[model samples]
Target: MKTFGIMTLNFESEALYIDGIAALSQSCGMECFHFLPSSINPLTQQVQGRRYSAIEQRWFDDEFPIPVLIYDRCFYGDDEHSKQCIPIVSWLKSRNDITFLGFGLPNKLELYGTLTTSRLAPYLPHSQSIKDCSEVVSALTKQKKIIIKPINGSQGYGIYYLKKNDKTIHVKTEKNKKIISRIFPNETKLCQWLQPLINFRPYLLQPYLELSNAASKPFDIRILLQKDEQGVWVERGKGIRIGNTGGILSNLSAGGSVIDFSTWSSSLPPAGKEYICSELNFIITNLPYILEREISPLFEIGIDIGVAKNGALWILDVNSKPGRKVVLQTDPDLKETLFLAPLLYGKYLSQSENKERKSNYEKTLYH
Candidate 1:
C-alpha cells in the first residue's frame, strides 16, 4: 500500500485535526506516517521512534508500512523549539528520496521591501505608502479624509484615520481617543503631527471607506479558498468579522466577532446584496490569478475583501496560511474537505510515481 508522512513541528501534539486527515487517508487505502520535529535526531539526521524494516526498506510505525510523503505543516522560525526544527525540514527537502507535498525550498515567503504594496494594491483599501508627511497631508487636503496603516502589520494594529477640515485635521485611532483633533492652520504643523509614524515604519495612506451604518464600524469578509484533489479552486468557507465596538479593523485577533454572512446579507436590501456578491466573486476569482502571477508556488490563498459604502469591493489582504478556526467554527461540515486534502495529494503523488516508473521501464526496454 502507498504511504504518506506529515512533516510537522509536533506530529501528535498540535493541529489535532491532522489526525483526522490521516484516518481518512487510511480509509482511502493509503498508509499514513507522522514525522514530528521532536522525532528527528540531532547528530545522525535520522528520525527516532520508528525504525526502517529490512524487508520493506521503508520507515514504518507498524500500522503504516510504506515510503514517506512529507506534508510540510510546521510553523518554524518564529519560536525557539520550532526554529530548531527548520534544520530537520531543510535536510528532508534536500534528500531526493523523500517527496515534499507542498511547495519546497526557494518558494518560501521572502521579505521583499516592495512586495506588500505591489502585490496587495488590488485588495488594499485606497492606500499609498509614503515616507514624506507633506505628501500625506497634501493627499488628505485634497481628499478631505484618509486612513493610514503600517505597510507590514497584522491584525488591526497601527491604523489611523484622519479627517481634514478647513483649518485643522482630526486623527483618530480605531478604539483610542482622538490623538489629533486640532485645526492645523499650517501645513507645517500637519507634517509635524505625522512625523513620528513616517519615521517609524512605511505607512499606507488610504481613503476612508464609509461604511453603511454610521454607528457600525467598517467591516470586512474573510474567505478561505483551497485547491482540491483535481486542483480545482473551492471556497472552503466564509465568515463576516465585525470589528470591535469602536474599532476599524474586524480581525478576530483584534476582538472581532464572527457573524453569519448570509444572515447579515439578507438583512440588507436586494441591491446591496447583489452588489456585495458581485464584488466578492470578483475578488475571489481575480485574487488567485494575481498571486499565481506575482508569488510563485502558492497553492492556496485566503482573501480578505472589504465592501465600501458605495457597494464597491476591495481586496484588503491575502494570507498564505489562513487560519482554520473560522472555517471550522462556521461550517463544521468543512472538516471533511480538509481531511480529503492529504488523500488527494497522496493520489497525485502515486500517479506521478507511476509515470516515472513507466518511463524508466520504457528506457530499459529500448536499451
Candidate 2:
C-alpha cells in the first residue's frame, strides 16, 4: 500500500480534519501517518509519529520511514518554532523521493506582481508594498481611504482600514468578533502608530473600495478549487461570507457567517446576476492555471473576491492552505466528498508511473 503523511506544525492544529482524512485513507489503498517536520530524524530519515490502522480504526504511536506522499498543512508565524520548522520542511521538499500534494503559493506582494501581468489584471486591486509610514500618509491624502495588510497574513489578521478625516485619521479593525476603532488627531500620530507595525513586518497597501452591503456589512465570495483524482482542476464549492456590521473583513475567523451562493445570486437583478456569473466564471476558469504556470503546482486554492458598491469585482486574497469551513457550512451534504478528496488525489499520484516531483517549496506562498 502507498504511504500518505499529513504534516502540521502542531499535532492538534487540525485534529478533526486530519482524522477525517486518515479515516478515508485505508479504503483508498493507502496507510496514513501524521507527523511534524521536527519529528524526522536527520540521520535515519525516519519519523516519530502516529500511524492510523484501518483494521482497528485507531491511531498508534509508531516509528516509520518518511511517507512517499505528504500533505503540508503547516501554518507559520514569527515564532521560534516556526522559524525552525520552515527549513526542515524546505529540506523535505527538496528531496527527490518525496511528493507533496500541493507546493502552496507565494506571499501577497509576489502574488499581486504576477497576477497584474496576467489577463485577470483588471480584476485586481492596485497594490503597492508599504516602504514607510509616509507612503501610508500620502496614499490616504490622495485616496481618502485605504487598506493595509501584512504580506504574509491570514485569517483576516493584521488588516486595518484607514480613512482620512478633515484633520484626523480614523483607523478601524475587527478582532474576535468586535469592532476596534481609533482616531489619530494628526498624521504624526498616525505615523507613530504605523512605524512599529511596518517595521515589524512587510505590508501591502490598496485603495479601499466600498465593499459593504446595503446594511453596511462587509462581505465576499469565497471559492475553493482543487485537483481531482484525474489530476484535473475542479471547484469543490463557493459561498458568501458576511462579516459583522461596519467591519472590514468577511473571513470566518473574524466572526463572519456564511450563506449559500445560490440564495445570494437569486436575489440579484437579472442583469446584475448575469454579470456576476460571467465574472465569476472568468476568474474560476483562469486563476488556477495562471498561478500554476507562474509559480508552482497547487492542489487547492481558496479565493476571496469582493464586490464594490458600483458592481466591480475585485480579488481580495488567495490562500493555498484553505480551510473547509465556508464550503462545509454552505453545503453540509458535501461533508463526505470533502473528507475523501485528499485520499483520492494521493492515490492517483501514487499510481501514476510518469509522475514527477516538481514542487519548489522555498518560493511557494503559504498563508
* Cα TM-score per model: 0.66, 0.98
As a TM-score, model 2 comes out at 0.98
Expressed as tens digits, the lDDT of each residue in 34-57 for candidate 2 is 998999999998999999998888
The CA lDDT of each predicted structure is 0.61, 0.91
Cα error of candidate 1 at position 239, Å: 2.4
What's model 2's overall lDDT? 0.91
The TM-score of candidate 1 is 0.66
Candidate 1 residue-wise lDDT, 103-164, digit = tens: 42121112222234464445455446678988787888788877787655545567777878
List where candidate 1 sits over 4 angstroms from the true fold. 1-14, 22-25, 28-127, 130-144, 150-152, 157-203, 212-214, 349-367
Q: How many residue pairs clash in each candidate?
A: 4, 2
